[model samples]
Target: MKTGAGIREHGATVIVAALSTLFASTLILGTGVMTAALDPDLIESSGTFRMVLLMVSAVFIVIALYVGAIVTANTFATIIAGRTRTIALLRLVGASSRKVRSRVAGEGLLMGALGAGIGWVLAELLILAAVTWGPGLGWLPAGREYPRFDPLTVGAVGVVALTTWAAAWAGSRRVGSVSPIAATGAAVELRPDAARGRTARTVWSIILIILGAVFLTLGLLLGMLTPLALLVAFFGGLLSFTGIALGAHIIMPPILRLTGTLLGQGPTGRLAAANAVRFPERSARSTIGLVIGVTLVTMFAVALETYGSMTQIAFESDPALAAALAETLAITTAVFTGLVGFSAIIAAVGMVNTLSLSVLQRTRELGLLRALGFTGGQVRRMVIAESCQMTLAALGFGLLLGVFYGWVAAQSLLGSQAGFAPPTIPWLVVSGIVVFGFILAVSAAVAPARRAIRVSPVAALAVD
Candidate 1:
């Protein structure tokens, strides 16, 4: 079947899923090939090394899948919000919400399968090219053999497809709430009061946060005994973050208001700020993906810096051991930063997509403003202001989360050997993040601002 703009808008979701699958497949297949090429004696003797490899690959796969699922779910939720009119109309024609939701989930499954296939093919080509050329380039041993296929890689594809389907189903929950009467009116978004009315969600979020805090404390206390404390801390971070995400509508508005103030009190700035807070859910959805991305990057940087500092301090008498620790930490940090970069890219795609959809949905509002003496420049500035406000809010929240999580992780893993130490702030990385965020805000706004400015007042006002 031919696809519409709605389907096309899901390009980010597909790309995220594809990237996740590709990364996971490459990790799994690459490990297998490298192990296969090793001497049998070495392989048998290196059980600990092999186990560590497996654990690292598994951790990364989980991270990829988790990030992919969140992005996909958010994308679907945004798409469904835009389709409120269509869904209401379907309801008016007697179509059940279950059927509508099922249809959306099915589309998710198909898109996931398509993305997974693309990722698999890309992985194959990438590995093939690397393996074929690396020997000649002296990157690998000349006589080593690399396998062309691994059955384990296929599991990643299936897992991604199923996860996407589940995420879509979760995202489509809003469809059930759309009444047939909504078909007669213009599409509406959830206001602050309406958002606050989700008392059950708020309560659950609080409960999760409390539980997460407990787990984090336990992990810290246990850190003196074993590195396994990190496992507890990981679950704590995940739960707390999930709770924050669930309650973002509540958490984001204040931050948006604060950031909006930074944009000055100009008419355009006021309008932009009001628009951002007007639909709390929309603004939250727009910024949460970015929050996840920044949090991850900052977390790793802080963790590595903290680890390095503590190790150096602990081994102050042994310069050689300290130097080795520094070298190892640097290499590990580089590898992790590259891996986490994929999630950042996914978040960028999501931010751009959300901004574009927001502009498209606000056509009537933009037209009204234009008709009421707003200039094209004013309209454009308004859109840009809104985008900047969201970006600022995400950056602040993400950095805070990252630092806390990073400190907890480092302390949990190293407190026994190094004792409690202050988190080593990576000022350079933080500054770079701030600079890149500004650039991202501006770049993401350009297309949406242009689209908003191009809306003809007369035509837009006439639109349903």
Candidate 2:
């Protein structure tokens, strides 16, 4: 790669690392605040709401961490592979694959460590904001104390950074195996043995899906609402994600191609269109994370909306119940919303990771175009465009699903006799979700795009 190209790619890598750090840190800080808020005396008399919120928020954090790690790792792997020809050329010219791998790993580690630090600071701010927002909304009980900074948050963030770095290294392991021939423009090797496992996977996936459906149905039917039921819901949702991803693997390509024909023309549009059908597993994995977030958020949204009205009615039924019910309801609602947001954040993180990975995998293809005269900026734009397309498409579908689920939940909780239209969708809420999704998607694409820009045309062309 030329000096200019190398600079561009490195820049993209930096951006990606920075964005990941910001999100991960914020996620941790929020978790801490949510944890403190779970205290009954601090938030309310009944801590159930706070407890639920904390659990949900924790789930969100977990999702975010998982997605972030995957994306970071994939980005490195792809860059190495994308520059396969380059790596191979170097190898052909006596550059060791081990050296190439180590350099990439070191770069990834640097980013992870730095990002983790920034994330910790951001997390602190998020926690404070959450606490302030909660009490301002009359959600907290009187005299409930606000949250403060803790060493644990910093410690946790550090751990996350290290873990992500390790994961990135793991993802980049394939660099050592890239044939010098690959750098010389040879096609990547395919593994028939891995492909052979698909049939068994499909069958097992189907079974899990059935099992998940059963659990979800039973949990809903028995009205036996408990943490256990929530766990069941989590499992059900997870299995469903895997099933859907598998299904999409088999189903999306033809559909995406057909959709692309209807959508328009150009590499950007075509790429977007093609992507919808390509890599069904990755796309599905991304969607699955979002689905979990949507499910949790939607469930709480419906539940709290119903709970508020019910509590108000109970207050009217007996003035004595007013203060207690209101206090309980307020705290619960606040916690629920906060937690659901956390879940959504988690989903967003997952999407970001998947998108990043997607870009990284195409490093070689991207490099070839650069070799053919595409600018770094163009490569970057392509990566961003792809990420945006996926995110927006998923968001549109997810929102529709969320609305439908919300409506059903409202009906069930309110009962048929309770005549009322569903609550209006607040612009703030809609805007927040959309904005959040867009930002995360863009952030996810940044690193891979940067990496693509840095490839030397000669190296890219000679990649083997």
User: Which candidate tops lDDT?
Assistant: 1
User: TM-score for model 1?
Assistant: 0.96
lDDT of 1 by residue, 1-464 (tens): 22767565677778877887888888877776677667767867555665677788898788778777777887788888777888899999999999999999998998888888888888888889878997899776678778778887899899989998998898788999999888765556788999999999999888888889999998888887888899999999989988998898899999999888888888999999988899998898889988988999899999889989989987999999999989999999989988887777777777877777777777788899999999998998888888999999999999999999999999899888888888888998899888888899888888877876786899988766
Q: Which stretches of candidate 1 lie over 4 Å from their true place?
A: 1-4, 37-41, 46-51
Model 2 scores a C-alpha lDDT of 0.57
Score every model by TM-score: 0.96, 0.60
Candidate 2 stretches greater than 4 Å from native: 1-60, 73-77, 86-110, 121-151, 169-180, 186-207, 224-228, 242-262, 265-272, 275-303, 306-389, 400-464
In the predicted model 1, the residue pairs found to clash are none
Residue-wise C-alpha lDDT for candidate 2, range 1-464, written one tens digit per residue: 56754443344344444444455455545555555555555545335654564555466556555545544554454455456667777778886767877777777667667766666656666666667777778665345565557555666566566766676676567666776667546434224333334686668768777876776564444323332444455465566554644454443333434435654576666765666555554454445455445545655565566545644553576776766776786687677577467546645654665555555555567778787777787677767766666666566655665654454444334332343345434345557677877787688888768875787866665443
- Supply the TM-score for candidate 2: 0.60
Query: lDDT of each prediction vs. the true structure?
Result: 0.85, 0.57
